[model samples]
Target chain A: MKKYLYIIKTTFNDSIQYISSLFIRFIGFAITMSILLSLWTFIYQDNTTISGYTLKEMFWYLLLTETITFGSKSPVATNEVKNCIKSGNIAYQINKPYHYIIYSITKYFADTLIRFIAFTIISTILGLIYVGPINNISIISFISCIPVFLLAVLITGMIKILISLTSFWVEDSQPFQMIYSKIILIFGIFFPIEMFPKIIGNILRYTPIYSVSYGPAKLMLSYNFSFFLNILITQIITIIIISIIINIVYRRGVRKLNVNGG
Target chain B: MLTEVKNNLKIMFLSLKYNLIRVMENRVSFLTSVSMMIFNNASFIIQWLTIFTLVEYIGSYTLNDIMLFWAISSGSYGLANILFNGANKIPEYIENGKLDAYLVMPKNVLCHVITSSTEPSAWGDLIYGYIALIIFNFSIKNIFLYSLLIIIGALIYTSFVIICNSFTFYFIRFSETSEILKDIFINGSIYPDVIFNRAIKIIFFTLIPCALASWVPVHLIIEFNIYHFILLILATNILIIIAFFLFYQGLKRYTSSNLMEARS
Candidate 1:
C-alpha cells in the first residue's frame, strides 16, 4: 500500500509538469461542451421534453457524459502499456519488486484524479452558468456517488489496460484503441442507455460498459436508492471479473515473452 | 514559376505514392484503420437521427440538408488530411527541429512538408462523404459542384491548420494551443450554422472560419448563391495567402533542435 502510495505521489508530481497542456485540454473540453450545449439547445427548441428529459436535464446529461469520458482518460498509461509490450520494455519491469500492473494502475489513477478534478471544476462552473442547477439530483445521492465514480474510473483504466495488452499480438494498438473508444462514445458516453431502443438498452445494462459511464451519470441525474445499490454491486462484480482477466492475461503474456526471449 | 509548380506537384505525387505503399504494406492494419474511421464518422449521424426523429428541423436544416452538411464537412476534412497530412504534425516538427530536412529541400518548404505524408483513414472519410452524397441524390451538376466545394473546403482546412501550428515559432510550446484551436474549428464545422447566434456566426465566418469548411458549401449546394460562393472562394484564397505569409515570417524564428533524424 505504501509503495503504491509513493507511486501515486510521484506520478501526480510528474503530471504537474504538464499543467499547461492539461489546461489547454480542459479548454478543448469546454469547447466540446459548448458545442453539445448549443446542439441540445437547438434540439430542445421545439419540444420541452423528448424521451422523458427536459431541456435542462438533457444538457445536464451531456455534461455528465462529457465529464466522465474526458476526465478518466489515461493516455500516459495507455502509451506506456502499449510500448512495454511492443518494444519488449516489459522485461525491465518484470524483474521489479512491485507488480507492473499495480504500478501502471497507480500511475493511471493519479493521472485520472488530476484530470477529473480539473474537469469537474470547469464543468461545474459551465453547468451553473449555462444550464443552471439540476433539480433532480438529491444531496444524499450525490454524496453516495463518490465511490461509484471511483469504481467507474477503475473500470475505465482496466479496459484501457486490456486494450493496450493487445499490442503483444498487433503491430499497433491505435486501431483497437480507436475502435473501443468509438464503441464507448456511441453506446456509453454520448447518449444515455435509456435513450437506446428498449431491447438494446436492457442488454447494455447487463454489460460493464454501462457501469463505467451510463450508470454513474444516470445516478447523478435521478438517483433511486435501489438503483444506486444495484449499480454499486454491478461495478464491484465487474471490477473483480476484469481484475482476474488482467491477471491471467498479463501472466500468460509475460510467459510468452520469456519463451520468445523478448 | 510554372516549371517550379510542376516540379513540386511531381514531388508531391511521388511522396503520396510512397506513403500509400508503406501504409498498405500492413494490409490488415490499413483496412482496420479505414473501416474504423468509416464507423466513427457514421456514428455521428445517429445523433442527428435521434434529434430529427423528435423534431422536423434544426435551425432551417432538415435531415437531408444536415446529411449534405456532413458530406461536405467529412469530404473536405478527408481531402485536406490525405493531401496535406503533415500540416497536423507541424507543431511537433517545429518543436523537434524536424523541419531541418524540408528546409534543405529545393521545393517550397511549406508544400514539401505538408505533402510529405498521407493519412490512410482519410480515405474512409472520403468514401463515406461520397456515400452520403449519393444518399442525398446523385447528379452530374451536383457532383461537379460538390467536387469544387470540397477542394475549396480542403484548402481552407489545411491552411487554417498550418497557420495555427506555425505559432510554434513564436511560442516555445504552442502544440496544445494549436491542437485545441484545430479541434474547435473542426468541431464547429460539424454542426448546422443556424444554431449559432449572429455574433458566433460572424466569428465562425471571419476568425475561425468553419462555415467555409461545411456550412456555406452546403448552403450553396442546397440553394445556388453566387454571392456566398464568391465569398467562400475569397476567404479560402485569403486564408491560403495568410498561411503562406505567417509560415515564412515564423520561419525566421525557427531554431533547429539539431536532432539527427530522417523522414522515411
Candidate 2:
C-alpha cells in the first residue's frame, strides 16, 4: 500500500510536467462540446427536451459524461501494459515488490485524476457559459454522484486492463480496445440511454457502458433514489466482475509467459 | 515541367509500393489492423443513424444524405491516410531529423515525404468507403462523381494536414498541437455544413477546410452543380499549392543532427 501510494505520487508528479497537453485536450473537448451545444440548441429550437433531458440538463449531462471520458483517456497506462507484455518488458517486473496490476492502476488513477479535474472545471465553466447553471439539479444529488463517477472511471480502467491482458493470447489486442472504446463512446458518452430504442437501452444498462459513462451523469442531472441504487449496484458488480476477469486472465497469461533476458 | 511531373509521380508510386510491402510483412497484424479499422469506422455510423431516427433531418441533411456524408468523409479520410499517412508524420520526421534523407534526394520534397509512408489499416478505410458508397447509393454517374470528388476530398484533406504539420518548423515541439488540429479536421468532417454559423463556417472552410472533404462533396452528390464543382476544385488546388509553399519554406529552417537511422 505504501509503495502503491509512492507510485501514485510519482505518477502524479510526472503527469504535472506535461500540463500543456491538458490545455490542448481541453481546447479540443471544449470545441467538441460547443459543436454539441449548437446541435442541441438547433435540436431544442422546436422541442423542450431530448431523451427526457432539458437543454440545460443536456449540456451539463454531456459535460459530466465527457469529463468522465476525459479522465479515463489514460491510453499510455493501458497501452504500456500491452506493449510491455508483447515486447517482454514485463520480465523485469517479475520480482517487483508491489503487485503489477495494482501498481499500474495506481499510476493510471493518479495520471487521470489531473485530467478529470481539469476537464470537469473547464467543461463546467464552459457549460455555464453555454447553457447557464442547472437550476433543477440539487447539490445533494450532484455530490452523491461523485462516488459513482469515480467508480465508473475505475471500472473503465479495469475493463481496459482486461482487454490489454488479451495480449497473452492474441497477436495484438489494441484493436479490441479501440472497438470497445468506440462502443462506449457511441452508446455511453454521446447520448443518454433514453435516446436509444427501449430494448437497446435496457440491454445497454446491463453492460459496462452505462456504468462507465452514462449512469452517474444521468443521476446527477435528475437524481432518483431507486435509479441511483440500481446504477450504483450495477457499477459495483461491473467492477467486481472485471476485477475477477483480470485476475483470471493475468494468472493464465503468466503461466504461458516465456521471457529470455539477463 | 511535364517530364519533372512524370518523374515525381514515378518515384512516389515506387515509395508507396515499398511502404505497403513493408507494412504487409507482418500479414496477421496487417490483416487484423485493416479489419479492425473497418469495424472501428463502421461503429461510428450508429450515432448519426440514431440521430436520424429521432429527427428526420439534421440541418438540411436527410437520413440518406447523412449516410452519404459519412461515405464521402470516410472514403476521403481513408484515401488521404493510406497514400499520404506521412502528412500526419511530418512533425515526427522533422523533429527526429528524418526529413534530412528526403532533402538529399532529387525528388520533390513534399511529394516524396508524404508518399514515403502508408498506413495499412487505411486500406480498411478505403474498402469501407467504397462499401458505404455502394450501400448508400449506386449509379454510374454517382460512382464517377464519388471517384472524382473522393480524390478531390483526399487532396484537400492531405493538404490541410500537411499545412498543419508544417508548423513543426515555426514552433518547436508543435507536434501535439498539429495532432489536435488534425483530429479536429477529421472529427469535424462528419457534421453537416448547416450546423456551423457564418463565423465558424468561414473558419471551417478556410482554416480547417473540413467541408471540402465532406459536406461540399456530399452536397454535390445530391445535386451536381458545375459551378460548385469548379470552386471545390479551385479551393483544393489552392490548398495544395499553399501546402507546397509552406513545406518548402519550412524546409529551409530544417537542420539535421546527423543522427544514424536506416529505412529499408
Candidate 3:
C-alpha cells in the first residue's frame, strides 16, 4: 500500500510535467461543449423539458458526461496496455516483485485524478458560463456525484484494460476501445439515456455506458437513494466481472508467452 | 506543366498502391482496423438519430441532411488522409528531426512529405461515405456531384490541415495548438450546419474551413447552384495557394535537428 501510494505521487508528478496537453484537450472539450450547447439551444427554442431535463440540467449533464469521456484516462490505459503487451514489457513487469495490476491501476488512478480535477474545474467554469447553474439539485445531489464519478473513472479504465488485454489473441485490439468509447459517448455522454428512444435507452441502461457516464451525471443532477444504490451495485458487479476476465486473459497470455518476451 | 503534374500523380498512386500492399501484409489487422473505423463513424449517426427522434428539423437539417453532412465530412476527410496522412505527422517529424529524410529527396518537399504515407482507417470512412450517400440521396447525378465535391472537399481539408501544421516550423508551441486546431476543424464538420449561426459559420469558413469541406459541398450536392459552385472553387484554390505559401515560407525558417533518421 505504501509502495502504491508512492507510485501515485510519482505518477501525479509526471502528469503535471505535460500540462500543455491538458490545456489542448480542454480546448477540444470546450469546442464540443459549445457545439452541443448550440444544438441543444436550437432544439429547445421553445420547449423547456423534453425528456425530464431542462436546458440547464441538460448542459450540466453533458458537462459531467464529457468529463467522464475526457477525464477518465481510458485512452491512455488502452495505449499503455497495448504497447506493454506489444513490446513484451509485460513479461518483465509480471515477473517483478510488484503486482502489475495494482501498479497499472494505481498509475491510471493517479493520472486520471489530475486530469479529472483539471477537467472538472474547466467544465465547471464552462458550465457556469453557459448555464447559470444546474437546477433541481440539493446538497445530496452534489455529494452523490463524487462516488459515481470515481466509479465511472474506474469502470472506464477497467473496460479499456480488458479490451487492450485482448492483444494476446487478436491481431489488433486498439479499435475495440474506440468502439466502447463511442458507445459511451453516443448513449450517455453527449445526451442522457433518457433523451434516447425508449427501447434503446432501456437497453442501454444495462450496459457499462450507463454505469460509466450516465450514472454520475444523473446522480449529480438529481440524487435518489435507490438510483444511487442501483448504479453502485452495477459498478461493483462490473468491476468484479471485468477483473475476473482480466485475470483469465493475463494468465492465458502468460502461458502463451511462456513467461518469455514476445 | 501538365507533364509534371501527371508524373507527380503517377508517383502518388504508385506510393499508395505499395502502402496498401504493406498494410495488407497483416490481413487480420487490416480487416479489424477497417471494420472498427466504420463502426466508429457509424456511432455518431446514432447520436444524431436520437436527436432527429426528438426534433423534426434542426435548422432545416432533416435526417437526410445530417446524413449528407456525414457522407461528405467522412468522405472528404478520408480522401485527404488517404493521400496525405503524413500531414498528421508533421509535428512529430519536426520535433524528432525525421523531416531530414524528406528534405533530401528530389521531390517537392510538401508533396513528398504528405504523400509519403497512407492512413489505413480512412478506407473505412470512404466506404461509409458511399454507403451513406446511397442510402440517403441516391441518384446518378448526385453520385457524380458527390464524387466531385468529395475531391474538392478533400483538397480544402488537406490545405486547412497543412496551414495549421505549418506553424510548427516556426515555433514548437504550435505543435499542440495545431493538433487542437485540427481536432476542432474535424469535429466541427460532424454536426449540422444549421445549428451554427452566421458568426460561427463565418469562423468555420474563414478560420477552420470546415464549412468549405462539408456544409458547402453537401449543399451543392443537394441543390446545384452555379454561384456557390464558383465560389467554392475560388475559395478552394485560394486556400490551397495560401497553404502552399505558408508551408514554403515556414520551411525557409526550419532549422534541422541534425539527428539522423530513416524511413523504413
Candidate 1, true inter-chain contacts retained: 0.67
Candidate with the larger TM-score of 2 and 3: 2
Residues A207-237, candidate 1: write the lDDT tens digits. 8778888888888888889989989999999
Q: Which structure is stronger by TM-score: 1 or 3?
A: 3
Candidate 2 chain B worst ten-residue window by lDDT:
B57-66
Report the error of model 3 at residue B90, Å. Answer: 2.4
Best by DockQ: 3
Clashing pairs in 2: none
Model 3 segments beyond 4 Å from truth?
A: A74-76, A136-140, A259-262
By TM-score, who's the top model here?
Answer: 2
For model 1, the stretches where C-alpha displacement exceeds 4 angstroms are: A136-139, A258-262, B257-261
lDDT score for residue A240 of model 3: 89
Candidate 1: how close is chain B to the reference, as a TM-score? Answer: 0.96
Clashes of each: 0, 0, 0
- Per-residue CA lDDT of model 3 for A147-260, tens digit only, reads 888888988888887788888777567678787778777777888888876898899888888788888888888888998998889999988888898888878887786435
lDDT score, candidate 1: 0.85
1 or 3, which is superior by DockQ? 3
DockQ of each: 0.66, 0.68, 0.81
The TM-score-based order of candidates, best leading, equals 2, 3, 1
